[model samples]
Target: MGNILSSHSPSPLSDANPSFHYLVPHTAYKVFINHRGKDTKQSLVSSVYHNLDNRGVKVFLDKMCLRPGQYIPQALICAIRSASVHVVILSPNYAESEWCLDELLLICRTGAPIVPVFWEIRPSDVRMENKNGVYAKAFRKHNKVGKFDSRTLEKWKEALRWVSLLQGFISEGEQGEMVEKITACVARYNEMASRQTI
Candidate 1:
């Protein structure tokens, strides 16, 4: 994982209208975290969420952001769509979870900018796996049941490939450093976006 700051020459979230980082004002959350909860929820993700939150950056993690209900909160969808940025924590089983993959599919559909954190995985691995039958069987099942259109799966893969190319911080040996960098990046983005409106 690579952590790049404003000096990053190739960031979609930087330079061009960087100050236009406006997120939904209806909620306190500024970032929508898309990750497989079982993978990083209790560990790195939680740490990062707490770090950002402590620094006054609200993050939308499902457990904390979701309303109390048996069904997925509609607010969660709104949060995803309206959030200024999406921090997608990519772990080994990220692709296997229908929940994670479907949320990713939705994030891609929104055309929102993405910040990918590859934890214990490589960019090439994500690219290669997504290109293959990453969620093929589940997609086929969803299609067969008329629950979802499999074509969107292509969009999700495409999104994964695109984000994998971005210079996001990778966490392998020094997870703390990666988390620090990620928190800084999110804070900077929030500052820039908020600046534009003022």
Candidate 2:
């Protein structure tokens, strides 16, 4: 709930040496937000995080949960596995970052119910249907890098395609309405998760 570091500040893939001793210990979360920080962290991400927090939903947002010296990827993966629901905010530049793609892969692997928020983009774009779109361009750049093998790239693409097929909210600029719908979905899952633990 505080003005902690922005979630986009840490590029998990860029960190050459990932450590764990400095991580801030935390309790279990009900919702794990998998988002492109630059696209939504300041807007929809903050709104959704605060809204769910106000409603007593324990949310895991990197900006609020991560500290300066924590192992970003490990901590994030832990958060993803701990949550009951994952809200993936896919934006125009979502595929540009390897970190975001890795996070998406992890979220898909969790097998938890995902609430995909297609912000300023379509499901087809996310599914790599439009070769000229932002996602395709991003993937092209990644392919050029040679840092990721072909199989890893294919896995990421598959994850994107799979999530695009799920029922999710599309924000065609009406952010408030989108946030409310996402909040409702998250809260519903949180309630279900709470009940299962009893």
Candidate 3:
């Protein structure tokens, strides 16, 4: 967990829906949690998801939202599109998972308000500025393995850069404080969305 670190907001998101070919809204899940399951699912994700749920926030977390036999990609895509705000938990092993990277790419393209919580990694790591670092190392491995094409890899890099620039929380060694900040940020969006619909 971390404390709040306000960075300069990035440029306004493009109005275009880049992933429209694959994603379409199916439900009104207000918050989408994009995280590395291995790193934060049991710890930070569980904490945040429950916190939001108890506060009457409708959240789309794969573990809690997906049924036993549902198609995962389709379900996730719909959830991403339907959500009003996104909470991206960036952990050290986050970029190592192709699934997380692809999810992040989709989330970025959605143009939704994203609250990036740097769990245990720095914003520089996510921006890929640390050339020989963990985040960059994961991309290098992905490139070497031939699993993701150059274009897809580049898109992931771009998504990382985009998220790293957003005003977000940095880990200050306190999980409770970080969770409270994220919850407040998302609650504000939820309130705004509710008003817009009214």
Candidate 4:
């Protein structure tokens, strides 16, 4: 189910008391998986993508193979815009890639439904302040690039903070279980899409 954007902020969350919300949407490809290819390609990301495909959910991963020196952002942006909901797989190195961050920033800007699956990390660690946080470092690194506009960078940072606060499923170590949960979440999105078109 999608989280209703309330006027208020949610209370502090702890491991013992977690709130999970999947931002389900109504669109063409019931789901769009936002992931870092290097971080989760051979494992969780691949598994989740295939599982969603097997279930006949149109996925936005077709542009995985781009020719050398291609305009990468165009393809990714088009894909994100066409899709209904986004499934953001946050692996350890997710924030390092400019593409992944750009995709996420767009997804957030559109206000689409999202299912954020955290792998090998806790919800608290995804915040912007943790000194040792990989996300924080990678996010900070992106700002140093001179070409991108300052306003766009600010939106990206805001998106990061907003998405991190949304309730989502986690994979401590059980990849199998995580895949199952993600698959189920996609299924829910599909259901929602079907209803909207009716």
lDDT of 4 at 80: 76
Backbone collisions counted per model? 4, 0, 2, 0
Clashing pairs in 2: none
Question: Per-residue alpha-carbon lDDT of model 3 for 61-171, expressed as tens digits?
Answer: 988887765556777777888888999988999988877877777787677789999988899999988898789999889889886567667777777888899989998
By how many angstroms RMSD does model 1 differ from the true structure?
A: 9.9
Maximum-lDDT candidate: 2
Clash pairs detected, candidate 4: none
Q: Residue by residue across 1-198, what tens digits does model 4's lDDT show?
A: 123221122111101122333233223455678888877778887888889888887787644434444344454555677777789888788777656666776677566688888877766667767867887777667667554556555555666677778888888667898799888977887788678879
Segments of candidate 1 deviating more than 4 angstroms: 1-28, 69-73, 129-149
Candidate 2: residue 145 Cα off by (Å): 1.7
Lowest summed lDDT window (length 10), candidate 3: 1-10
Runs with alpha carbons beyond 4 Å of true place in candidate 2: 1-23
Cα lDDT tens digits for candidate 1, 1-198: 112111222211112342333343235457888898888999889988999899988788877765543234345566776777789898877866656765665676666567889988788777765434434444455457664344444554566676789888787677788889888888888777677668
lDDT of 3 at 15: 24
Candidate 3 versus the native: TM-score?
0.85
